[model samples]
Target: MTPLPVRIAGTGVHLPPDVVTNRRLAETLDTSDEWIVNRTGIRERRWLAPDLATSDMCVAAAHPALAAAGCAVRDVDAIVVATYTYDQPLPSTALIVKEALGAFRALTFDITQAACANGVQALFLGSLLVRTGAARRVLVIAADSASRVTDPEDRTTRVFFGDAAGAAVLTGATTPGTGLLGWDFGAELSYDVEIPAGGSRQPAGATTFADRRHYLKMNGRTVWDTATRCLPDSVLNATAKAGLTVDDVAHFFLHQANLNIVRAAMDKLGVPRDRAPITVDRLGNTGSAGVFTVLHKGFSEGTVRPGDAFVVSAIGAGFQWGTLCFRA
Candidate 1:
């Protein structure tokens, strides 16, 4: 079936007020600011307050997006939230966002598999829903409090994660061929990045808590290698599907996973450095919120101009990854 056209009308991001500098981490851990910067290219990151949760940040981001889209809460037809951090396990964070935004009419759910790629995955799903006539307008949000799950004692993980939220409003394109062009998503069947426990398989227990199995875990080398190889391929595949090429993309909104990883992918795809805007240096890897956060920053800074064609790509836990192409 021919899919309907979809476009991103507006984008918004909310970062917690608390800033954690590499120096601050170094003060407690055995790592230094220089070491972290040289390794991850992250200088500082925002950590959410103990009192706040993922839904709070999602609501904070959603308001600006709806306003920017000239859309009201009542007008939204569906809400898709991408996050692994829910305040509780029962009611989905998407529903919480819908209630918080007072968008009682919207169908709400959550998507959690893509991990850091959740934002792009949500965008793809929202676009499909809008295109299929299942929804006229969709509010797609990705929020995460990675700090809450990060083990401070684990310097490797603690130094790289932070808290943030990002959102976008998607709807049918006013002009055809001016929105989403093509996308590709896939999982490579690996657990290179994951939280080992807390799910039904291991359910929370004393053993899990003592082992810190609930905290986020990663095989950094595996992720780096996998992303370096897969991200560029995904982008190329999606663009080719749309009858475009790497040179045709005006901007690149790749995941803010690591500075080196992004640089490697861009070099491999032959995308010049000037064409990609990165936010990981200051924001750290915000997990699912990273892609949209970078996109929102570009739009606000006027670096992403109207009629620009951009590619969004990410690799996350569950060995999941994807690429999305759009015309702004």
Candidate 2:
């Protein structure tokens, strides 16, 4: 029997109200706004208040997404959250989001692999659930408050992350070939970027806090090189698998990791600059939420239209990367 085609029915996003401009960081840090902007193309980023958690952002994003899909919370059969910055370690953040949204019937879980690419990964899984008839409507949410884990004094990692959440509703597509075309995911398994401690391998302790081992650590150059090479290849492979070419794609939704890396991938794929919409300048890198946030903004602005061919791609800390092609 032929399975149903999965499509993204609706999308929504929530960026915290509190804005932190580059100039604001310059007030206490040794760096200036110009330095941060020139290096990262980030002028400002949103930071959630201490009181809010990842699940809060997820709920905020999910309501609008479900509404847009013409689906009620009770109609959803599954909930998948992609995040590394959960409010707690034991209970999955997806369960908390489910409770907040009152999605009582949904099977809830979290995807922690692929770090920043977890959004695309979750979307892929949601597609599978709907296509396989295991779910009727699946809510895929990606949220992060990287500011909570960032080392304030570490300018490199601190200037690049922000707090945000994005959600999408997936269901069976009525139009044939009007949903996901093809997708690919891969990992290079390098620790060039990682949080050194707080996990089971290196449990958190007083010394961990003293040494700042819990903060994110990154080798920017290594990431730039690996992502630049791997991302374009992933896109090409997925497009080929889908029997399409780069020229057929009308919009590109690459991850908002860094402007320079995005530009590099565009150049490699021979995609024109205007074809890809970027959000890193204003939102910073919202971890797994980056791609979904970009997608939501594009849809809201009418930049991504129906029947348009678009590709979404990302690479994260674990050297994980994924690319998916879709027809809107």
Task: Kindly give the stretch of ten consecutive residues in candidate 2 with the minimal lDDT sum.
Answer: 1-10
TM-score of 1: 0.97
lDDT of each: 0.89, 0.90
- TM-scores for all candidates? 0.97, 0.97
lDDT of 2 at 302: 82
lDDT of 2 by residue, 1-328 (tens): 1233788888999999999999999887889999998888999999999998999999999988998888999999999999989888978899988988888999997998678998989998998898889998999999999999889999989999999999999998888678888888898778889999998888999999899999999999998899899999999988887778999999889999988888999999998978889889999999999999888877778887888888889888898899988888
In model 2, which regions exceed 4 Å deviation?
1-4
lDDT of 1 by residue, 164-265 (tens): 999999988877567788788878888768888989899999999999999988888998899999999999988887678999999889899988888999
Model 2 TM-score (2 dp): 0.97
Model 1 lDDT-worst window of ten: 1-10
Q: Which of the numbered candidates is closest to the native, going by highest lDDT?
A: 2
